[model samples]
Every structure is written in structure tokens, then in C-alpha cells.
Target: MRVRDVRAYPHRVTAQLFSLEALGWDDSWRELASAYDGCGDPGRIVRVDRGLFGVATREGLVRASLGGAVLDALAKDAGAAPCTGDWCVVREWCDGPVTVEAVLPRRTAVTRAEAGGTSRGQVLAANIDVAAVVVALHPEPRLARVERLLAIAWASGARPMVVLTKADLVMDADLIAEDVRVVAPGVEVICCSTVSRRGIERLGAMSGEGRTIGLLGASGHGKSSLVNALAGAEVLAVERIRADGKGRHTSVRRELVLTPGGGSVIDTPGLRGVGLQQAETGLSSAFPDIVALAQQCHFADCGHEDEPRCAVLEAVGEGRLAVRRLDSWRALRREAASMGTRSAARRRRALGKRPRRLATRQRETRRGVGR
Candidate 1:
């Protein structure tokens, strides 16, 4: 769909109308959503407001509230809430209310530890094919932040790519990109500048034919601008970076935008703090250099501390690896492990309450019999 076509429409929902197939609907989704056939139409979540959702379906886009069942599921699991990029069943009542009945299982989900010191995790985006970790070149790139985002992206079960934005602001963009490539082994790193329109085509190509690309990064990184450039129109709002190089929070919500080539991009609010959640696999993927070295250690369970014949420590001592890199690995590893522990403890507590509940039920049954 072209931006011009959308602009001509009188209503936003009607302008964004697209078939389920164009929105990345497939046979697999059909099978998963089969149980909901009689309940409603299949749609993709385009935007999520406080408690309302903008869902795009074959009929068009509609504002829908959460169904009773969906709300109940979210109460137990915050991650279960419908988010941008989710495919779901949308039901409309005759009285003029629409509700999202259920969300189909996600094929890929970018998640991070819930903010504010909680064990519960939040799903940043769902059913994505590519996770683009965006980093700004101004004020120099934060390699540590890149590494962290990569771990979260890798854990999302989607191919990860690095997008270096604001390339035009810095003259050493290529050098920075190469440095990033060194840390991101086996990942593609592209320098993009919305000003020069550099690398926009390459990034745009990532989305097409129902494929979804998700943008992940901190604020002031130009994610919204990138989405506008890719969509060939201003589909999202953009704000100028502050004098201190910090970005103003312009995109207050996460939204899925469709491009002219029939692909989708999910733009999320710039992340301030991204803690790891069950990202052991992502850590390994992000720090393959460390993982490869640990393989040759004397002990299979080498902690890479002061263990004898520790290849990892040797690499650090010999300057083959950055000590900071190793420290990053250890820190993220501990955080992820801590999350696992907390989750296990919560599960045990829940299980422990089950017996008490069952006993109460039995007592109630006995009283009924006595009556």
C-alpha cells in the first residue's frame, strides 16, 4: 500500500485496510487461529493503547478491547497481554463493541526483564522475523548497549541485525561500524542516515512479502525517523535530539506500520533500561567469542574465574579479548540466572498453595455431604 493511497482515505482504519495475507497471515497462523474461526475475524495488532488495541483485519482496522478470557490470562502473566505485532482473533458485537478474543502463539518474541525490579518479563514485540538493534553514532556508539540489545534480540528467536543510525553526524561511521562488527560476529551491521538516505534501501528490503522487522534501541536513536523513511511517508512522529544528545520521548506508543512493499515494521518506545530475562541462549549468541574460548578450558564446567587452563582467562590475559567484554558476559549471565531462580521460586510458591486450595475444596465437599 502506498502512502498516497492511505492519505486520500477519509478514515485511518479504512486507509490501512489490508488482507490478512498482506499483513503476514499464513497457513501456520490459520491453523493456530482455527479454533477462533466461529468467534471472529483474524487480524494483526497494529497499536496498543492503555487498554484498547488497534487491530487490522481483512475488513479493515478496528479499535478493540480485551475479551474477558484474554484479560484473565494477562492477570496471571503480564507477557500474555496483546502487543504490537501479534496476530489475534477480533470479535465485534452487534451493539458496536469490538474485542480481541485471543492472541495466537508467537513465532518470535523480543522480551526483556520487567522494569522496576520485577521477575515478570515483558514482550517487546512478537511474531517478528528480524530484530534490528539500532545504535546512534552521535556522542559515539555505546558498544555495551549494543551487546546487551543483541543478547535480547538473539533470545527472541529471530535473526538479529545491527543498524547504526546518524551516520552522517559522525565522520568515523565506517570505523565504528567495523568495531561493532567485531563484537557482533555473524551479524550484519549497516550504517544508516536518515539525512542522507544512506542504507535506507537495505533496511527497507528486510521488510516485504509479509515479513516483519522490529526496531529495538534506546531513545534519541532515530527509530521513528527510520520507520518514516522506510514507509516512504511520515507514518510516525519524530523529535529532534536534545543538546545533551538525549532523545525526547516522541513515540509514546509501540506501533506496527506497513510499507509500500507489503512488509511491516514495529516501532516501539525507546528503551531506557533493558534487563535480561531467560536470555542464556542470547548471551551465548551475543558473546560467541567467550563461549568458543571456554570450550577449550581444562574443566567442562569452567567458571572462567581463576580456573587452571582456562582458555577464557588466558584470552583476557593475552589481550586476545577485552576484559570489559568478559565482565559484560559475567554480569548478564548472573542476571539471567537470577531471573531463572526467581521464576522457579515463584512457581514453587504457586504450587505449594495448590494443596491448601485442594484441602479447602475437600472440606467444602464434606460439609455438603453432612448437610
Candidate 2:
């Protein structure tokens, strides 16, 4: 495989590879892309495990570890990590192990709040063009959850689509479609069933040639099953949720699989709880209807709790909107804003510590001189 061949995968990957090459890569891939000029192999990270990553290079699949300079760059830029779909530069020597020297810039990245109530954003997939938010029909579909996922999908700097799984199990597809429309109004909503193969063809068309789509949903939502069905083979493992309807983490890692017709899909582990970190823009965009209503509120900073002429409350009272949807939006908005503030504070403290330590060192030097 060659560097030019690897660049043909997708727009995001192609752009990143070209950008790195234009910047003149050398021994180290720094922010400015100046590195030691030598032979560099291009690859996309498929999975990261035990401090090693599975990179699909032009030469073939190879396991590689990050070099010292790359690790230092990651430490400087917290957002820079080897995520699935990221186009990276690798050094492969026959006599030694391969090392990831640099990760190219991403055109689009899907990020969400860490599920553990952490004030940090978790990059789910990088350099993806589309995000297919999957939801199952079993155990009663939660529209609120769908809305939440849509918000994150939109925030990821990628196009968002809703994929309703297990459509064959539900008797009335129209009803489910109506419920989904409330949250993802203009976005495409696909109904599919692995058993019946309903809407599979349409789903394939939406992905387009050479584009990458990411699958995201809670466990038992049939994400892996859908991936297997689309691939026409059992590339991913499938497992049944518990009797109580809770899903087990069958897909332990995120991987990109090629589709038979065209394009690729990334299947990730089922997310139990999705947090809203650094997604304020995505939240407002996902629920534009609610945001527009809030704009008409009497107070500019109204909490919508007991504000006078609250347009949001008025709409809910008039049956134009669901109360639960508004509640969910408010909850997520507050959480996202709070998380952003906390993260900013932490960064400030960390930065402040460095200056304080420097000042202390200067004082100690003066004291030593006086003594």
C-alpha cells in the first residue's frame, strides 16, 4: 500500500493526510507539522488497547505505539488522541516495532461528555462525516434519550441521522416515526430490522461512497447486529441483553468496518449513560424548536422555572410541545454548561500552578543569593 492509496478512504482522512504532507512532516509531528524528513507510512487507527493501537496502514494492519514526541503532543493538547477514524503517520521498520509519530488534523470529530460525571469531553470517533444514532424498539423507546443522543451527534461536527432498529418487532412504524420526528425534525430517520432486512438498502444509500458513519446507542439497541447485517457477515459479536432489558458490553472497542456496496461504519460499545460536556452548541442546534421558543421568553436570562411570559412553558401548556422534552433539554443544558465551567476552572488552576511554582523558584534563588 502507498500513501496515495490510503488517502482515498474518505474526505476527512484525505484532507488530514494532505495537510500533514503539505506541512512538511519530519521525525516529530508537532502542532506546526515540522518533522524530520524521512519515509512515513499513513494509517487510520482502528482500535486502541493496552497502550497499543491497531492501525490500518497501506502495508496492511499493524499494531503500533505512540512515540515519545507524539505522547508529549497529546499531553499538551488534551483533545489530541488516537481515536477511531483518525488518519495518522506511522514509522514501520522491519527490524523493530511500528510507532505512531503523528495524528493529522480531523475534519470532523464526535465527542460527548464522559459517562462517569467527569468534566471532560470524550472523543468517540474522529474524522467521521456522519453519525447514525441508533435506538431499539424494545422496552419502550425513550424519546428523551434519542434527543440527548441527537444533541451529541450534532455537536460532533458531523451530520446526524437517526436509525430506529428492530422495526419489524413494532407493529406501528408510523407511530415510532412520529415520536422520532419531534426531536430530529429535518434529519433523516431510518427504520431497519436485521431479521426482516427492512430499509437496509436505504440505509446503505445514505452512507454514500467512501463516507464514514458512526453507530451510537445504548446497549441492546442492536448496533452490532445492524453492523453485521449491513456487512453481510458476522464481523462483530452479538449478545442478548439481560432478562431485565439491560445490555452487556459486547463490543468492547470501536472499529470501522467496510460496507459491501460502499462506505464504512464504526460500531462502538453500548453507552449506558451519555453525559453532555462541551456540547452547548449541539444542544441548541438539536432542539432548535425549543431554543427558538426560549428566545421569545419575557426575560433574556429566564430559567423558565417561574418566569413571566415563558414561551417554552406556554408552548407546553398549549400542547405544541411535550413537557418531558423541554425538561430533558433544560436538564442537559444546565449539565453541559456546568461541566464546561468546571473544566475551564480546572485548566485555569493547572495553568496557574505553573506560574506560581516559577515565582516560588525565583524567590528561593534570591534567598540563596542573599544568604
- Of candidate 1, the 10-residue stretch with the lowest lDDT total is 3-12
Q: What are the per-residue Cα lDDT tens digits for candidate 2 across 172-250?
A: 8768877888779668887889999998888877555666788988888899998898888999999954665554688
**lDDT for predicted candidate 1 compared with the true structure:** 0.89
TM-score of model 2 (CA atoms): 0.85
Which tens-of-lDDT digit does each residue in 31-75 have in candidate 1?
A: 999988799989999999898898898767788899988999999
> For all the candidates, what are their Cα RMSDs to the real structure?
4.2, 6.3
For model 2, the stretches where C-alpha displacement exceeds 4 angstroms are 1-39, 240-245, 355-371
**Per-candidate total of colliding backbone pairs:** 0, 4
> lDDT of each model, Cα atoms only?
0.89, 0.77
User: TM-score per candidate, in order?
Assistant: 0.90, 0.85
lDDT of 1 at 127: 89
